[model samples]
Target: MIIHKSNNVTVFQSAVFQLNTTVVATEDLILVVDPGYLPYEIEQIRIYVDKIKDDRPIYLFFTHSDFDHIVGYGAFPDAKTIASEQFVTNNLKGSQLQAAINYDDEFYIVRPYQLEYPRIDFMIKEDGEQFQVGKTLFNFHYAFGHNHDGLIVTVESENLAIVGDYLSDIEFPFVYFSFEQYGRTLKTLKSIFEKNSERTLITSHGTVTSDQSQITKRISDSYEYLEFVKIQGSGEQFEQFMEEKKYIFSTIFRKRHQDNIMVYERECEHS
Candidate 1:
């Protein structure tokens, strides 16, 4: 369903994971960020973008290498693809594709387009790398933590950001990578917030927010969670920490919180 819409942007939320597919259209370019989840939902995004984008170039920007983020790749064969250099070179491409295949097989869901890993047409190599398409300026920042190749895209023209998995309201930091890396990404995000004026923040898993205080609140939540994970004692439960923060508990998110604990433990050993 359409959660939010503005002059040149429309945000589509999938029922599966509250996964968002953001579309930003202009005279020269139509950018689609991580269009995904069920096959029908992806098709709807494609149809909607196709209808509005007349002679503009379509760009499919993958924020990370996660299976869910890249699962809808084959749906838009004609769109020029975009991703971070790390994502393009990640060795886990085969497993990522298989994860998508596994999801389809488990649910007996069928899709018309072939499910394949995307071949990026444009690659973001460094932080603050800018891509210009007419009046739109896409500033790409490498955001590592949730996934090693995670990216955060900021549309300077719109003063809007498409953050891959970070700064989410629905969930806390899902650090599958490293706690330190996640913290670093949070700092980067905070810097971004400071540099920009009041901005609209679009997260993949949560509702969008334009209020600066709310954006600041999400960043504070991340920093607090990062600190919270560091206090992990021997065999301590993440659920305990979750309760202390008054964060909503769920079986699925419980597993993610546990995984955060494990990642923190591993990072602690290395440090």
Candidate 2:
């Protein structure tokens, strides 16, 4: 667990767990973004929050409701949790938690970690509205397509945005919920990044970026990589493509297995 300072907040990098949790603190409050996997880590985060600003009312915001992102919610009992209405309606309830567990067990070969239903505070902004916590105002932009309810949070004070899985060192995009709008979403994000080149973009998987050129390049590369795979004919062709594109492949290969390969194949066959 390595913690890096991001102007007024701290971003905790979880390499082993493959998630990045961020904490934003103000004089009277603490705002935590996208708590990751591991019940123990969540407890640690709660303890940290309490120690630093005792009973300051931690606000847990879910950028999206993927298994890795929400597993820690159980640890923050007193805090209020907010997320896209679509996420809560579709995937954050009790039955949804069971479904998530089954989904992981069948596909990712992992059991769903325990989860606490967040307070169900509010809906996502319809037109990129802003949510204020104390002195800082965090802008919530609806940038779906990677997932139907995905969001990007921009902090007004730091000139930085916490973009969850919108970009990564990984070559291909892992989108669930909607595939048809994936390309358009990437384009939208690229446009936003271009407009805010001086503002830092923090991805869940890797480094903070201020370079729009690199962000653009990564998105382009990700799309191109997926396109190349889509061009391949079948599952066997996908295997060959993977071998050829070994330069861009990562541990996401074997573990994610059929999902990672089939998604590209589906894009080729359908898109």
Candidate 3:
């Protein structure tokens, strides 16, 4: 369903993960960011795009290469795709992505189109890469930590930042990559927020907010969680940390949080 729409931007939230599929409708193009989740959800995005896209070119942007994020690639086959250069060149790219698709297919999951990895026609290799779509200017930044190949897009004219998976109010820092890199990424996001204080920050898994306090809190909370895990380890202290943050202690998330500690330990050992 459409979660938010104003002027030329529309954000659709998938029921499965609250994954956001953002549509930026400009006079010259329609930009779709991370269209994903169940089959019907993707179809709804396609239908909406078809409704608003009037012969203009459609562009697809994947915030990262996660299975859920790229599952809908085939839905917009003709759209020009964009991503970080690292995502385009990863050695495990095809196999890992296909594995994700296979996992979904194992559940008898049906999609409107055949599952396929996105063919990235445009790559953002440098920080502050700017592109113009109609009257809007989009600045793309390479964001690491949550994932090695994540991106944070700023739509200057619309005053919106389509952050891939970082700064989520509902999720703690899920560092799939380097914890050190994640810390750097958060700092980068904080800097971006400082400059574009007026822009609404839209995270993939949480509600959109322009409130500076909420944004600042999310950044500091994530950073503090990392520090707590690093110094405290996965012991009573870590458990207490989780409790203080009101983090629900689920077996799955607990395991994920534990893994974060493990990764940090391994990195420290090697360092």
Candidate 4:
């Protein structure tokens, strides 16, 4: 479906091909975010980049260290791959990267999505630190909670934010709370929403939201879901109950739970 392009920047997102892929072009460089699942999807992005950006030195950015977000990176060897310092430090090991070569285990499972470990450069981006590629300027901010160092990039000129798994339509497979830290991060994202209430948000999955109200609603609902799990059921029971919701979130939730039921137990203990 090539999920429809969102307004604001010269950004184009691919259809649901594992992890959603986004390409943001300026006058010169072509920056692609999360190169989907397969080589073919990356190839599609390559073709598009060639046609539009003249195949200029590509800048590939990873939102986190997850395999789905980087399965196809080897396809673009010449591109400069950038990621958060935390993700780069933890995931750059051959063992860590290869452990995810197949969806066999949790914490390090790499699905058979055409795996690749690209050369990564670490750039610790925080609020207001701008990443400039050609004419486009993307400012980074913390959208943690989903990942220890998750990032949300805002295209300054266009007023668009490229938020990765930070805001998933997929109900959190399990609550991810680092005690009060996760709570603070969620609050930070809410504040970002309130400040940029009129800007458009390009989520890692599903539809692009033009209204902050939608972001607010989704975050609130996800938190509610987490609370529901904490109060209503044990980790296993919450897993079964959430399956009943039947939204697209259910699929990811089920898969995650199937992979790591203990993660939920840990989260419950923390809460």
**Highest TM-score among the candidates is held by which one?**
1
Question: What's each prediction's TM-score?
Answer: 0.95, 0.79, 0.94, 0.78
The digit string of per-residue lDDT tens for model 2 on 150-266 reads: 778887677777877777754356655445566776776777677777777777766666777777776886676556545544456656655764534435554344464566566
- Which of the two, 1 or 3, has more lDDT? 1
Candidate 3: regions farther than 4 A off: none
Tell me the deviation in Å of residue 29 in model 1.
0.6
Candidate 1's displacement at residue 255, Å, is 1.3
- Pairs of residues clashing in candidate 4: 2-15, 100-109, 100-110
Question: Residue 35 of model 1: what lDDT?
Answer: 92
Q: Indicate the worst ten consecutive residues by lDDT in candidate 1.
A: 232-241
Q: 1-271 in candidate 3: lDDT tens per residue?
A: 8888888988999986788899998878899999977889889999989998989999999999887788889889889999999889876678768876787868888766677777899999898899877776889987888778998999887788899988887778888888998988888889999987898888998688889899999899998989877874676766776677767635666788888888888888999
Q: Which is superior by TM-score, 1 or 4?
A: 1
- Best-fitting candidate, scored by lDDT: 1
- lDDT tens per residue, model 4, 1-271: 2664643133434444235777776666677787765445567777776777665678888876655676667767667877776666663446546645654354353433445565686475555577776677777776555556567777666666777775556545233434244455567667777787876767776667776667887778666655654464546676566665444555556665443444556766777
State each model's CA lDDT, in order.
Answer: 0.88, 0.67, 0.85, 0.62
Question: Residue 209: error of model 4 in Å?
Answer: 1.7
Candidate with more favorable, higher TM-score: 1 or 2: 1
Could you list the CA RMSD of all candidates, in the order they appear? Answer: 1.8, 4.2, 1.6, 4.6
Full ranking by TM-score: 1, 3, 2, 4
Query: Which pairs clash (backbone N, Cα, C closer than 3 Å) in model 1?
Result: none
Q: Each model's number of backbone clashes?
A: 0, 0, 0, 3
- Please give the RMSD of candidate 4 to the true structure: 4.6
